[model samples]
Target chain A: MTENEINHIFQTWLKQHKALLFKIVRSYAFNEEDRDDLFQEIAIQVWRSVTSFKQQSAVTTWLYRVALNTAIKWTAKERKHQDRHESIDVSQHIIESHQPPDDRLAWLYEEIAQLNEVDRSLTLLLLDGFSYKEMSKILGISESNVGVKINRIKKHLTTKSEKS
Target chain B: MEFKEMKKIWDTQNDEALYVINEDALHRRIKAKKMGTKSRTSFSEVLLIASNLCAGGVVIISHLLKNSGNVAALTMGAMMMFVGVYILFLRWQRIKRDQQTDVSILGDLENAIENINYRIKLSQSMIWFCLIVIALTMFTVLNSDQSVFNIVLISAFFIVGFIMSRWEHKRFNLGKKKQLLDLKEKLINEFEM
Candidate 1:
């Protein structure tokens, strides 16, 4: 497709499914700056790959795959220097359960933040209601692994909720 | 948490402030294409300098040899030509490598660090090569009977060039490492949060 047509399709998709993108970014980025950076990166990657998008899978599936992979690589690289700084500030940003505003969502994110990288991604996809097969494709893990990881994450969340 | 509960929370969440993609800014970016243009200019400048230096060296050496019938000037010209060819070939290879991959913005940032590291390595090698060649030429020209003053001058030049090149190499590596670390940290924070 022409660049304009590709861009038009992307804009429409973005308008429709922006929340999913934002949700992934919000789960992965530390702050607004990082989120914006990832968003731009994701947009650029989507644009680059649009030419090769053969419609073998749903567009949403392709988007999630790109988003998750980009976010994972980005986070892995960022962890090298900011570990000390991140640990100190993480608690402050932890979502407080009783708050009525964004804090509640922050709480959920805080909980997500506590998960290991792989589990965190699996949980995010699961929360988005992707089936195990789709999650496997996006994550490059086996379907059984997705099932196993999701079950464990669910149990862990339940335990955390009970204590809360 | 259940999907229903999560969806409810998601629904209630406030809309994030919309990011205004300034058309003018994007237009400027398209026009400027700073990195692409800068890289192109740098490659071109290096090529021009190398070509001119090599050609000038050869012409001067030939003229000097023709005037004085000295083989030493001819040898210096040949050496300069070799270095120039090497530099040209290196630059061409680098440009080719850069063209092989297409990356997004973040990938570009990531690749920028790698490119910096690559440049550092190249600079370090070039510096060492230049130093070695300069030293060899001075030693061959001066021989054991060479004046102390000439030897000292040559030594000084080599030492200064060596020092500057080493400093640049270290600085480039340090900057690249810091950038990679920052990118790593940002990614981790996002994932953890």
Candidate 2:
């Protein structure tokens, strides 16, 4: 595809599906700097995916695959860099600027921030209402495994909500 | 709150925009990122290939200019040119392989790990490459009919170069290579109970 064509499709997808990206960012990265970093990384990955997307899956699935993969790798890499960290790059200014958040949503994100990387991905999928089959395919786990994970995560979130 | 209520709150974010994006900035950054990623990933290979090719070119040009009979320089020059071609071929193959889009997150994670492993290996090989270059230089210098003082100076120069390369290689592996391994470990062990 030509550059303009890729840009058009990317903009369309971004306009249509940015809420999903933001949720993943919030769940994966807690601080503003981390959020911006994750956002930029995901955006770049998504843009790169635009060319390779053959539409075998929904655009949302493709975006999630690319974005989640980037976020997971990035989160791990950031842990290594966190100790000898420099200030945020000027790329920090690219995508995300947060507004005041809803208290309940903020609480939910706080809870998500406490989960492990794999569980965090499962939570995003489950809360986004992806089916067990879809989650299994996306995560490369068996459907039964997806079911078991979702049940455990739901229970944990429930217990935490009640205690709070 | 029930799971149903929690689901409802999550669903509320479906149409709600939690974060504002700057589209103009995003466009600019994405273009720059595409360009940056290309250069950043291939910069080392470019440097290696270009330097080797330059070494080969200089050797050939010197022989032509001086009409000298230097068998060692000619052989080393051919070897450097061969190494440059070999690196180019390997890079082309990798680029071909990386173009395919994997179908799942697990596949993506595996690809990322593989790419990092390649980088780690490349960094390790680079230190070795430096040593080989220094050894070759020393061989050439030793074969030359230079004054004893000139031979000493040349040997000292190569020795210092080798030491500096060793330090740089260690520093690179410690920072970037260690983090890459950590990320790979995290990805592979992500599902562990």
Predicted model with the maximum DockQ: 2
Report residue B123 deviation for candidate 2 (angstroms): 3.3
- Global lDDT scores for all candidate models: 0.62, 0.77
Q: Give the chain B TM-score for each candidate.
A: 0.59, 0.74
| Worst ten in a row by lDDT for model 1 chain A | A87-96
Instruction: Candidate 2: count the clashes.
Output: 0
- Per-residue lDDT tens digits for candidate 2, residues A24-79, read 98888878767766887799888878878888898888888788877887877755
Runs of candidate 2 with Cα error greater than 4 angstroms are A78-100, B27-36, B64-66, B142-168, B173-177, B187-190
| Per-residue C-alpha lDDT of model 1 across residues A1-164, encoded as one tens digit per residue | 88699778766766666667767777787675566556555655565567656687888787877777667666765544332332122222211123243766777788888876556777777777789987766655467766877777888876776677
State residue B171's C-alpha deviation in candidate 1, in Å. 4.2
User: A60, model 1: CA deviation in Å?
Assistant: 5.1
TM-scores of the candidates in the order shown = 0.53, 0.83
* CA-based DockQ, model 1: 0.11
Docking class of 2: medium
